[model samples]
Target: MPEPATRIRPMGRRAVLTGGAAAILAAAGFTPAQAATGRSAGKATGEPTYTLTVMGTTDLHGNVFNWDYFGDKEFDDTQHDDIGLAKIATLVDAVRAERGRRNTLLIDAGDTIQGTPLAYYYARVEPITKQRIHPMAAAMNAIGFDAAALGNHEFNYGIPLLRTFEKQLDFPLLGANAVDQRTGQPAFAPYTVRTVRFEGARPLKVGILGLTNPGIAIWDKANVEGQMTFPGLVEQARVFVPRLRRAGADIVVVSAHSGADTSSSYGDALPYPENASTLLAEEVPGIDAVLVGHAHAEIPQRFVTNKETGAQVLLTEPSYWGRRLSLIDLDVRWSGRQGWQVVAKRSQVLKSNTVPEDTEIVALLKGDHDKVVTYVNSPVGTSKEAMSAATARYEDVPALDFVNFVQAKAVKDALAGTADAELPVLSIAAPFNRDAAIPAGQVSVRDVAGLYIYDNTLLAVRFTGAQLKDYLELSATYFKQVTGSGPFAPDDVTNAPTPTAPSGTPDYNYDVVSGLDAPLTYDIDITKAPGQRITGLAYGGAPVGADQVFALAVNNYRQSGGGNFPHVSTAEVIYNRQVEIRQLLIDWVSAAGEIDPVAFSSVDWRLVADGTPVVIEG
Candidate 1:
């Protein structure tokens, strides 16, 4: 018996294979050795081909070490125990060693400076706007990144910090679509061209264009309102791609900080798509490959054929948080007519745990990491009992009510002297993280940060009673359709449209109300369709009138129509504050010195299926 044929995927190989030849090689029992010996038999060749390797990292989110500051330990999700730039630096070194360092290039697809507590500590607690080199900048510089794209989260801390962080980087930060409001020209370097030669042959020019997400305009409206404008990805690609080719670039690659999906959750909210990487590759011409991110999805390799030219564009997106590295290898040779053209290509996403973390990175950022550790561990308040958010999605728990109480009280206090004070107020809260909890003994800043992971501000919007009912109905869609009321696993109650979502509905979408009075109770029937799930929605012991108006307390993300909530963005704003909800919670707890469940915690909602009340385990 003959040994099984090896997969012909290219890995730092200089040999060029036509699409037809690669497919026929295995079936014809032809080996790579035979191809090398009989190279001249196929066609006339003038020069030898060269192999070019491109590596990429995205959504690093300020994670330099493999440590999770929230848990104060090495990052782990039970199944996959890997994260951060230390692991990526190790992988980059291995790839550079395998494929000559001169022939390799490294790039990051943004979202580098704002996810963990470490990032927050640097940006807010210790302002990096000064001359100090940002941790992300220092780490990326150590890894030798050639270029990067701007992610939407990059604007969360405003442009001054972003610009300061950019000045410290050795490479050009690319963002073709991030434009200036006054001039409408690219605010940052739109593209960068790097020239390199392999085997001391003729130099090849590689042009890289970076495109950011359009959702930045909505998400970071306050920070970038009059300073920066974000245009569509496809629009900017059409303009820059031609310029790149005219600039004599042999290979044109795009490092798009956008997702692979073309669909926008905020339909018609923005003129362009928020996640338009697939569209850019399919519509634009002369792009050889694309590195996608900002969606945190794992796409090892995808090939999209251009509609007009029928040319193939290779794409790869490694998983977020430095867990994986997206690698693309292209074999280019001097085509007598077309000059240097890519004859063959291959791509893969390498896991971070396969290699050990680089020790140099751990040593370089140890001081900053230690400071962040001290910042998070500092006590904020005390908790009477251990409050866990694990059951927030399954039951009416005090863990979420605690947040709702703070938000509602803040809004009422702000609207004290205004006409909106007389209106009924309902505060909305979501269980952002399932693992969020406060120990029985004490509560720290990290505990509150874990509970409200995002940097969202508070907003009090005025809504009609009909719109309020619509909001609850939309949230009711989180529950899965059920039949029998018998005991069943809560984990098995997920009914998301896609399988990739978290089980038992996403905690971010399971919102709870905090100000409804008695006999105004409502029950969600898991057995019914989404729109009809919420039954017996009432106010003041009667069915809520459509004309009745009220003030709804919610975060800015939802007020900007996040989570696809109904009529949120269209509602009139009665009160708006720059105060972050997390900060408010910390202040409220600190002033009281302890959490009192009797102050706000109560059960006003329940679940029913088949006319039988459903009981869930706590």
Candidate 2:
């Protein structure tokens, strides 16, 4: 809680000038004498100043300890960063001790449940609604959260589960944008006001507004479609910020489940951009700071100048999975006329690895953590041979083929007696985790779950051959253009960056398509530019006709425009059972008791330069 040094910059012409004569003198480029005199006058008048510290965490994703349920060990990254609420709790206590417990407030920007196996076990295996408390709830409540914004993933397990998780929380789970469809009113608490009291001074009222991403409408459409609606973040902030001011809040802070960047992965499916936290700060007045989430990026401090008022709003995102904590300190001054005003503010992110896990939190959730560990490690089936996804991004591999096979077969069997039964079934699978592997002789739930990391459910969409070709072309953009068939490392050719993905196309965005009963063969001619990479597309060893129809087994993320993939979002939905794809793979293996790649693996696709196949190494 030591005050970090901040570089000062001039505010815009329309900036809202606060904090008595000292701020006005500084803004007007007056001499030091004038500024000091203004400060002395304010002090002589007996005005009091205080620093309020707001600490926040986002995208916790069900982490309670610095443990990896999938790996059955302590979580470790290349950076050696520690994870979970246990570490965050230690950091929180340190901040509170330094800044005074009453002066510091702790809150979270959402994605509380559903990431690790612990969250899944509670949601699916032994549901918390069935007379049990969620580990996340227990950990967060123990840490004393003030409030939390609703993340899109909150609806992944449906509203009932989210409500149960909400009911168990000590603080409110707010979502101003998540509204009742019939009434168009907020479905959850839009904002909450907390008062910090002093012995001799008037109490300071801090208003916390919560706004969720608009993409929830597309991402969790099945869970919230008719029941609720998620409008744009900026739209709801405009309505609520003024209400907070009217409610006599001296400081306004926003816990936004949106990114600072103004971008959307779902294209124009929603009217608003998915990551609109900056826009919210700029367009909404009376907001002093914003705790951003959902992008999984680290932004220690970013100042967005409000267009209308020109007041600078501080924004910070603490990465994801409890890796970091965002701290915003507001320097406020009180006057007889204005109760309290934020005179100055700055933000910074604290690395969770710098501290050890809090013993209290570690002890509190040990039972839940152990249960998940035993569950993920329990053997479900056996594999004839080991399969790895390390090279699956640039080449066809049985590791991913097995996923496609399970998905395609499930869709085919589900539509056996339906009108779409005759349609050739194809399934799409992505190398979600490069380290994912199925070891020979044994396969556990974690093995399959690690391969398909997301909680996306399966859906079958009807697509014409022409549309399928276009979809393949879009996915082929993952690879960069290559000239010769020389040996090349996989990284040298795959994960080509585009406008949407500035860092590079993620493995999850590069899908591999395969057939259920036959091979869906194609050549990704990386020699050509994007939109022209897919070539020689065929099904059942025959060239697919433009009008030929087929059923494509796809995850809800892609089909609901998660990746901005073409055709699939607008295509007719032929089947949707709302069954999670990971669960399907687990069920398939448990029933079969064996994973034989020979039954479904095939060399269906390859990367080619012009007409010759490209040789990739490593």
Candidate 3:
């Protein structure tokens, strides 16, 4: 079956309607002048009713297929099997077919680009700027997206690349809260107007206002610090919702790249909250529905009532990586007094694996996929011995040591001539992917990429001895307390499955400290409380003093307070660049000629339960 056609009319020169009675007129094939004059042939007039289905997808981190290029296999997480845009395409078609094509609107809530090997290959290896179209733009265009909001990760590669990406998209990339530093005007269009015409009912004008997380200011400060400013999500929505209503929108939908968490990171210290979907829905007046993202969570539906007006606002979030599709169904009736009001509403989260992968999307990007597969398969270096992260959570592994070596070397090179060059340096890292392994012999780009799966840049920060000890203690909390002498299971040390109240520690939060010599090795006792888990910490054959100072090699995410690590974000930064750690690994491996596991590897940390050996079975 052919894809449904979508029409998105920009509100260019329509008469500004400020009063409650004033309505914006928009329909297919209607010009701005005709809409403003209210003379369009199919304009909404008398009492009429209709249904509108709003479909949303968010946090599609460049998973175009079910294939995992790094692992060279189909994507599977063991628990839930569905993933990628090809799966999402099937659901989109089904929903559009069930509802009238003209009444269904598709929207995306950001984090669209820059995650998988496919996206990274296009962005770094073969830039999309040189190519005609980005794979993301091509896929989204083929799927007929009406509008999209911006996410914080979108600014990681810099504004030039983001501009190139925006130009290739068929839909409007809206970020109403992202304002220019000098002009204070929206850098991107604040909102988009979609005019829907039912068979015999009045035209329904839906306005989509886009709001992104304000953490972009801190996370991507290098790229967007002075160029653009991000205000609070609720603050921006308050300003645009009224304007959208004034412009004749009967229903307003907010495409918020912020998550549904109501907690405020700034806590009155700053006006902008990092995650504020719940707050926005409760505070904003004119919004009918909100599409939330950026936390990578699944929330089918949540209704928040405005305190003053007592009006209900519906919110929905589809899980990340195109695993699910969020649908919001609205039944509206035309009232002579209020124009159009939603009388009934329903929502559902559809699984992406319910349908087959869209062959059209797979065929459209075949050349790009093949190029990435070749690039990741090509050998870059040789490993003298096999390395694996299987036991990394319980003890140190060579895979993590290799990463630390690269990070420390990069920091040393970056601070070569700086004042802090002579300071003692310690590098910290975590095993991101537990299943990652490297066999002895030729090592390909895929092996290295799998080891460091995240897109994190290197950073050098100054930390006092006390802060370093605190950091290690925080890392030790990943292990659960063992009451009696018994064989410990692997899952016991793992964090609580609930993300908000994680128990022990996550593999990503387990820090392995390098640059410490013999006699300085430390052990973690899981029987103690979280803050007192670290024992016998020493450096250079002596106990680490609280007043001692050291330079730490870390990632941008940790340095920016991503996991709520202690004192790292406030530390004095000495070196930072746009370079990614994975790329550095590739460069370091290529320059070293050969990697002998014994040269830079060390077993400096281990997990023990009350002076007893803890068996780690992998």
Candidate 4:
């Protein structure tokens, strides 16, 4: 969960792995001397047939309780409605039941510890007691996660909390790439080998090596920036493969918290596009298959060449947010002399169709689920005006502005007594869930929760006017600049955005900056380099130099330079303070009793040069 520098280019993307991955097919636990003589543990007498099924859930993002921020209600799908530890537990049981005991193993890739209001509420007010585990972890433990890995967001609560949670884990948390800062040894169990025997007396040893995306520095800087270091994922793989082999693993599987993009295949098999999950497959030797996540994309099956060893690679990813689950069925063999290798493999999706949620796991988590419901569904306040996110119908709706105003207030409050307490506080916010806009009229508890779905914490950092420009330029890359016309097509309904252009306006620059006197603008061409993305800059009302700094309040992800933004990563100072923005709004509005649309206005977006110019919409 750490990265090398400010560059968005993944240091792990090209990390090199070593050794012959093909050895799996020949020597999977078979003696190398025996394999050389064309003999395996049973090859001499008979062909050893073994089938292993791997069940994986990735990017649950703390959906342990059945609450939904989007619906402002319990997520009701079918069996008791919506996905939660209960439902996933049910689903996991059906999978194992269908597969039987000897043939199955269940694992989660990452983001298991953070992302819901329950986690938010628990972390802040309720002091941890051995009697009461964080509901999410408790549910996961009840559901019985066999092995799990760290996601970048897991570090949000900082290591102390994680270390506490770690004590309660029923299974090993495997991470091969993450090393201890003190000795560069694996911080957690680098990889775990579990033996499962579908048939016969002695079980086959299955090796699982977990690798989280090395973007930890980007999202968890507040809690984990300097405590540890991360090696290039590829480099770590090379070192670990040899160690895993020496450890007597029969079959090797990787649970990668990274993701895949639509990249072209290189020669035999290219690591499945844009995703290190696929890349991890090809690059690491002796790995039979990969369970992938972090992109939130749904991938059926992608075949790629091991970039490091030129061995074949297989990968699978179910979408994020509990939308899907990926299952891999693989045949493996072990040669006495060589090691373990893949014989055949396939992937299946964990959809509602034909799959019923497990009844038992659901029962185990219901108590925790009900507790969350009691709090989340309680009507703390009400609004008379109807609210919606239909952006096309209107711009800068009341609910939108309300979120910003409340967040700014929290930031200001959190910084009390600090030098920045009175400094011109700039609050940065983005609408993850938006539409036409929040309508004017009676608002329920569900209304506010629906608009802000992500369980994100508020963060503030000190940035220079120069660093601020660099950060803004990075955000600007999200917008697409229209050539002869404005940045956006007024009638373009799909929200489809152009990636790059002769003008090179990125369509993703969606930010709300609060409390600024003079408006601001960036005149530089984005087609230029990173440092030069800003051709011109302004403050309160004047041209600003690069050397100046400002106190910037942003979400945990942005403050860490997530989304490949520049300058945020290189800031000279970080306060390391965190405020749960979503809950703060919930808290603020609940305390306010009534809401007003008049409070939300922005000093963020400045005037443009194009006639009736449009900005690329995100």
Among all candidates shown, the one with the greatest lDDT: 2
Q: Is candidate 1 or candidate 4 better by TM-score?
A: 1
TM-score, predicted candidate 4 vs. hidden true structure: 0.77
Model 3 residue 100 lDDT? 50
Candidate with the larger TM-score of 2 and 3: 2
Rank the models by lDDT, top first: 2, 1, 3, 4
lDDT of candidate 4 at residue 488, scale 0 to 100: 49
Q: Roughly what TM-score does model 2 have, to 2 decimal places?
A: 0.92
Q: TM-score of model 1 relative to the true fold?
A: 0.90
Give lDDT tens digits, candidate 3, residues 352-443.
Answer: 66456777778888887888899999999988999999887777888888888888888887777989888777899898988888779998
The candidates, ranked best first by TM-score, are 2, 1, 3, 4
Estimate TM-scores for all models: 0.90, 0.92, 0.89, 0.77
> Which ten-residue region of model 3 has the weakest summed lDDT?
21-30
- lDDT winner between candidates 1 and 2: 2
TM-score-superior candidate, 3 or 4? 3
RMSD of each: 8.1, 8.3, 8.5, 10.2
Error of 1 at 175 (Å): 1.3
**Clash totals for all candidate models:** 0, 1, 4, 83
Question: What value does the lDDT take at residue 581 in candidate 2?
Answer: 93
Give the per-residue lDDT of model 1 (tens digit) for 302-324: 99998879999999899899988
**Local lDDT at 255 for model 1:** 97
